[model samples]
Target chain A: MIIPAKSRLWSTVAVFAVAVGLTACQTTGGDAYRAPINAAKTQTADDPDKDSGAPTDVSGDSVARDDGDSGITGSIDDYRIEDLSPGERPDISSDEASVWMIADRAERRAANAGNAIKDPALNAYVSDMVCKIAGDYCDDIRVYIVRVPDFNATMSPNGMMSVYSGLLLRARNEAQLATVLSHEIGHYLRRHSYQRMKDTIDKTNGLAFFQVFTAALGVPVVGSIATIATVGSLASFGRDSEREADGYGVLLMARAGFSPHEAPKIWENLDAELGDTPRSRSFFYASHPAISERQTMLRALADEVPIAGGGPGRIGTEEYREALSPHWESLLADEVSKRDYERTERLFDALIADGFRAGAVYYQKGEMYRQRGDEGDEDLALAAYHAATQFIDAPPEVFRARGQIFQRRGLNVEARESYAEYIRRNPEATDRKMIEFVIGGLGS
Target chain B: MKKLVRIAALASVLALAAACQGYTLVKGGSPVEVGNAMKVSPERSWSKLTSGKYEIWTVDGPILQQILFASGVEDGEKLFPTDAQTPKTLPEFKKGMTELEITELYRDTLVQLGGTQFEIQEIAPKTIAGKQGFRFEFTFATKEGLQKNGIAEAVLAEDKLYFVAYTGAKLHYYPKNLPDAEQVMGSVEIL
Candidate 1:
């Protein structure tokens, strides 16, 4: 059942009370957030495969020892490809059972809320690709293509994968997309969420103990804020888990016959688009390893992996473009609406460099320049719009943009003609009445 | 004195509850001043809320439906608060902006307010407060996945902006309160 917000708050308070009660008897000081290593790591360590040479302790200590503060070291060469056979599910502990229940409830709520994109063809395409990487364990996974414009894909412990449209827009080819999907699948395979949840509970309990003590000392507000901060810190993956997932993902993509080189390229392109922004401080970035670190490790792993027939393997650029072509306008529109003109401009430049859809790229570039409206931006916007119209597949909004610019410049005759052309091209446009009104004013 | 104390206790409780819910009742048939430059006449009771420059009125709740007003917003001011460190990148209103530019400003405001997916359904010139202005219809979804439909009208005069907007959930709330919102919009006048 969906818990009401107030009830959920009270339940959390109850948990806090229990924790406080437990802490009242103890006097030892310890860091609360550090929980046990992931169950997969623990299990693998206990039952080390004699053939694989995988590390026994896949923990942060190992990463710290290898990489130090440079965030570069700890190669995935030690990780081995697990034999995931058909009809095999991980044995769940009681803790994992509880997490599974929570994940199930969340997945049900998300589906019921109409957030899951219901396009059968698109769903099949993405799921088929995921299954290719998943191998015999494919049936255990369910993919949801959500219409969010953030570069993220999440894997829930209950085998629910949400692929956001922003990832699709950023991914230049199928191999890059596969790389992300495989990484998320790696999280599921490693059972990171279950491990993370247990760690969060331990942290919360500790924070609650501290909170109660602080409240007793007459600083309830500060204590409450501390509790929130402790919880918020749990959202990002731990460094070791991220490293493990990255290594596993590279192996999985190579096994699926996708070019493993695309993995590093994705991060390289992302770093270029990000351009030294202090995103590493953000919670979203904090959860994962540094981009440069991941890129370096992925490149190393890709170089080590042997090609099936010594070929470049499948990039599937044309296939990926074709699958997403029908949704390009709406996706590009979402990207532009973000109003991050610099980032959007960089993205458009990359797309143009790829030479896939020049007309769409120019149209979006026009939008970015038009919306920014800096000194000399209007002329730049006009040139981009004109360039867009030179292609056969230029969006109908080009005429509207041209008309608005012309009208602003007091070129009434040109504005009228442009508006008329826009109206003629898009007869069923939602703003038909509005454009008509502009045309009438130009006549006067 | 005892009775008065009891009454005061009840009043405090009610106030706390109202604050927790994020709205206060604006009695029906009341004339509410919106911003510094405009007044609106409401035919029915509504919830009134304030966040930065936007004065919001709602029937069900702010999450379901809202009517927002902003008057005399100065140039160089943002429609919403932005991260102080990244001020240059955030969209801000400028003086002598054309109608299209103003519309873009509003679009950016909605985006900054966490509208993940946004589309302008319609835009055109309209009369607001007896002056030439612009009106637009739009649809968007919040980051939290709330689908909303909205309409807005704005006029630039006296080197300041006067604006009103209504937004509601696309499924039920928008259609239910759109007519009432339109009527409230019609009743706006520059004072």
Candidate 2:
């Protein structure tokens, strides 16, 4: 495929991102620059050029080294989360203090950001989840649920963590959400971002490696990836850092009474969403190399840590469903607005499979097709809308949409039924009079 | 390493070329046709980008303040350019979109275009282009962390869309230029 120069430049950066000699800053694609922002764990262990259809290589053997190791390390059991408290403060006039200052400023801005999900109920639920997984340091972290429509989360050194709306939409249950949260918190506890700042920068090659990303941020061409990487810790977080976070995430899940088994499923869903993007392959970024290996790795870690109560861990699918159900429509609306057909479809399919608010998820799925209006998408949209009406949570807009489609198909009777249903369901609709006029125009 | 350096150098040169897109001066009181349909008379000189169906005019840099005029948006076209080849996730303008959906498309388009912390403070019915339309007010922060406020007027007539929006840094630029933007848009004439 003849990729556009702008895209080609970014692919060049993502694929051939000038290597940070110490770590090879494996740049993945858009989603890699996003969630769990490691794309977090898997990089193809083999030559990147040889990597394609990278997800299926899930065998435990495809593991890439953390730093300079020859192979995957056995017994991640030795990893220790750093001790931290809510009362801790960075020393004044120190490098760590400067990072904290920048983060604090970013936090203040993020706190007031318009894109933040301001619903008190939703914010409280996410904060409680962070506390559950974070243990003693829970008080140290402040969570911001950004309304960005991508699967990513990041915690700045100053304890400010942003969980994107896309991640919430993608994660099927609470455990999956906890997985990402714990992973970010792990990065925080480990001081990974600080290490990256002091260790990665100042290194000549690393500086050179980051220059393109820095330039991309100001300019538009390749900046989308750089944009995510810059704010989301994409530029700084490395491979081993991801593995460690994954380990901590699993442990935290087990500790918080969530099934650690759900942890790796995040990657499985990500691979499904990303499909054949370069970020998924070894060609570039080599960010997400083997899916099953990481899954296996996560499973192994989960197996090692027993849930506290042995009650199969609190999967909490219902509670998670209930908490997010109220906000799914808005969250999915943001997700759908990205207009990535295949990925959005995958997300919908996952939501459907989860069976939580099927009406809401299917309604957005229909809207996706309706907005794209591609060939045969009309029929697909109609089918989706029809399916959505079967559930209680479908928005009133679906009937109006179906009414329009039916009217277009010259099925006035069906149109009237759909339109009437819309009016019945939404009596207070601002456009009620308009719908009534449209119905009158349709005739009896 | 050498091969990568060569590519990076090529990327820099291309980036420079891309960045140097010159702007033309739209002198005060000059009636300029925008988006091949609407004609507006600016009350004062402004800098306008000299390309594409989407027209943007600025007094200070665009990061601080700008006026955007989008006209003749037909079915299946997006309101703003979808920068980069990521996805068609940017909302598209379909024919027969209701005012509510249109406002949503504009808001979503802005967010997808990288404005964050967005909120529509108010949206109410009004008149634009001698037809029944709508106007709305919103506040958002740019990726660069500058807070901004915006006002827009739009109407969909005969399966085409005409929109005028002015956005500026919320503190001073937005309030200072509010009158000029209003007068400029107030002079809009659809051809």
Docking class of 2: incorrect
Q: Judged by lDDT, which candidate is best?
A: 2
DockQ of 1: 0.15
Cα deviation at A217, candidate 1, in Å, is 28
Task: Tell me each candidate's TM-score.
Answer: 0.74, 0.72
List, residue by residue over A165-235, the lDDT tens digit for candidate 2. Answer: 87888887899899889888888887766665454333434432343343333221121222222243422
What is the TM-score of each candidate's chain B when compared with the real chain B? 0.82, 0.86
A1-444, model 1: which lDDT tens digit per residue?
Answer: 233323322222222211121110010011111112122132221221111111222221211212234342545556654634455454666655645654564466457343456678888999999999988779988888877555777777777887878789999999999999988888777676666545544545564344333322322121122222211111235677777778888888888889999999988887777664453224235446778778888999888876555787789999999998888886787788666677778888898788877888899899888877789999999999998888888888899888888887888899988888888889998778777876887753
True contacts kept of each: 0.09, 0.04
lDDT of 2: 0.67
Clashing pairs in 1: none
